[model samples]
Target: MMITLSLSACMLRQASLCIPGPSRTVLRGIHQSGARCSGHNRWSKIRHRKGAADSAKSTQFSKITNEIYLSLRPPASPDPALNPRLSAILAKAREVGYPKSNVDTAMNKALNPNEGAALQSITYEAVGPGGQVGMIIECLTDNSNRCVSRVKEQLNKYGGRMSPTAFLFERKGVIKLSLDPGTDRETAFDTLFEVAVEAGAEDVKVVLPTEDVHDQVGGFEVITPPSEVSTIASSISSPFKVIGVEVAYLASTPLRLPANEEDGAADELETGEGLGDVISEEVADKVFSLVEGLEDTGDVVKVWTNVAEV
Candidate 1:
């Protein structure tokens, strides 16, 4: 009798741990996947490490350097206090492990027009596989032809084509903020929304905890009109770490797959049984590969796409 009682208790305990209202197969799958219900976990640690390494690499360093140079281009003072954008870019450069010497050199070039090559800003649009994905590539280069050629070459190589994606993507101001450790979620969100609306923001998105949340650096994504980004970002009060203030290409609508190409079953939606999507791992990998190929171009700084994660 005691043995049977103990077994019942054990089964009940395990059942309680399973995601609410899912079958045993789902529970088993979650277990096999090694997913955790809580925010802090081994997966989170791995993601954080990967993000740090990626940010400190050559491409990221170059991007930050360009940002610093461009931020100082308005004939504004190099003193960060005088140019908030300059301050933000410098902070980013330092965060990415860029050398202080390099930072100073870039600033000097920006300050003295004759000191460096004249670089122009260029944007290229491309359509990805099945015209389901759209991308906008922003580049700062001294040679326009070289930049365009490089971009076109990459697009052709990756089954993408140069086309106008502006209709699909609109430029919006994005302000990202990271929630401080131990902060109350409700309070933080309330404060963020209030500040954003007051400062002319259009929408606020809570960066949902995802398998990639482990890789994400920020906790919230705030959006506003292109002209209002800086003002809105500056108004958000502290305790929340403001990550970046910039203009980005935000998709006006999602790109949906045809029924035959649709990945994953309706049952897998919000199952909490896995770290990522219900889509077969193969499709997800292909999508990311296409995006990464575009971003890897020497002159490509930012690549925005409308590809929806399945």
Candidate 2:
């Protein structure tokens, strides 16, 4: 009887996956499968993957909450509309699908630390495989020791080690903008570049993945001296909308990961891909896994690395 009921649930789940919107009759037929068959192993696999994804998403939201809370620290107003920096951070938080309630809770915590344990920012540096990858981990944690231990555990697990890698990177402001599709490419680029340069921006270039290219100039990134980031971002107007603006740790020297020449060639042949792409997808996946592990630690706020972003 127990097996029959379990099979019924699995059949219902499988039926739901097969049918975009399973009707009442289809659902009833799914229940009938329990009487004839008990084979539904795929349900366990599907459930496991869903559970893992939900857990990861939960951890990510917690980290974002810490960021929202940290952004609301005293001297900065709890009202995002009144504080430009906080407003920008809030916009970023919303872009990432952060809940408004969580944002409000974070603001409340910031306004009243006595309501909860106060959070503090901490930075840790680590060197990745071949000392080729350098990372500056920025964390907001109530318990510094716990954050340190978790960070160390992730690095050690991923064949990385903690060290003084901060010197390897320079702080800079990075702003991402969305360009208007109706505008001329050359004209838009020239105008935004001119505006950024005048505002002390060091460089400006499109930052979208070529593999996901569209007809229009979707967007671009602006790099500036750390202090000038906000000054330049605020100056960008009209055709270009500011999507993201934040201080970033840019590598002083280029990353020297072993080029996956063979994979690159294969990918290009298969999909017309180009060069200067990050270390191969496999290596990038591994690096991302390490990064995700660090982020999963509740204390970690943001993880930055020299490994090229995909």
Candidate 3:
């Protein structure tokens, strides 16, 4: 089996600035085997602001440093508007409870003349315990050694090992759309169908729902092959909000794990437990934590795993 596994900044002058915003596995007891990142939205031409934070922890400056000098190599602009990836990174940072001030400092430093962070692309390919396949973990980092070490440590702890055929996932386009709750579900479905057909989006998933009763609509995630993202965005009407758009890895084919006797195998097609139900929360947390730590190392960018605990 195999598993494949695979953020932000801004600033204000003086006191200012702020901003905000799965699955696969191979087989039982099988040793792991072997993963690419593809995108043309180059981010090397934006201008970044100067960083404001000095502390090590809880500092956007550090994150930005990781991005520019470590993750975002080549010292490009930190402007999210121009850098699609950075733009999403900023949004993700905010969503994760990152401080606004820290976000600013990171952006500020990326554009600094003295701060030279060389952006490098990294891809990790590994197999899992079963016959499951894997995908590439695309990352931008400054310290390849630290990133690899951290990733290896986590996988080894999880009863999985990084092997040499996990490239089964095809990188796809990602579109985060803010769903309109006010609209009827049928209307929403209509909107989705219209936009998807016009823009060529592949699928949609529910991310998180808004707690606000009045807010009605929370949001839905839209996915497309990397090539069709722009067309879908173009087909969308302006009243609907476009949260973030970028290229990301998505499994070309999904595999299900066995559960109780009721569970069906691939041949059944209509019957089977998805990875969501089979993977333990403890395992999820561990893997996610591993990802977070590697991401922090500033070199490893992506983690793609096909591991599903049944």
- Which candidate has the highest lDDT of all? 2
True-vs-predicted CA distance for residue 227, candidate 2, Å = 2.7
Q: What would the per-residue lDDT of candidate 3 be over residues 1-310, giving only the tens digit for each residue?
A: 0111110001111111101110111122111111000100011000001111222354433454454333233443455444444655566566556677866666666556367754456777764433244535556655677667776776575445666544556677777666654655435644554556456565654333333352335454566767666556546653455666666666545433323322312112212233222333344344444444444444453455553211
**What is the clash tally of candidate 2?**
0
Separately for all candidates shown, the number of backbone clashes (residues 3 or more apart, or on different chains) is 0, 0, 52
Best first by lDDT, ranked: 2, 1, 3
List the lowest-lDDT window of 10 residues for candidate 3.
35-44
Superposed model 1: Cα runs more than 4 Å off: 1-56, 73-85, 209-218, 256-287
Q: Return the candidate ranking by TM-score, descending.
A: 1, 2, 3
Candidate 3 global CA lDDT score = 0.44
Which window of ten consecutive residues has the lowest lDDT sum in model 1?
1-10
Instruction: Give the higher-TM-score candidate: 1 or 2.
Output: 1
Query: Taking the tens digit of each residue's C-alpha lDDT, what string does model 1 give over 1-310?
Result: 0001111221222234333333323321322111112222222222343333234378677777778766776655577755556666777777667899999887787777676678788988887655556778888888999999888887777677888889987789877677776777556766665666556677665443343433233356677788766666767757776657778886666343222212223112224322222233333334445556656665767777663322
Alpha-carbon TM-score of each model against the true structure: 0.69, 0.68, 0.56
- Report residue 148 deviation for candidate 2 (angstroms): 1.0
Stretches of candidate 3 exceeding 4 Å from the true structure: 1-89, 95-97, 108-114, 130-135, 204-218, 227-231, 234-239, 261-298, 307-310
Evaluation by lDDT, superior candidate among 1 and 3: 1
Residue 181, model 1: lDDT of 64
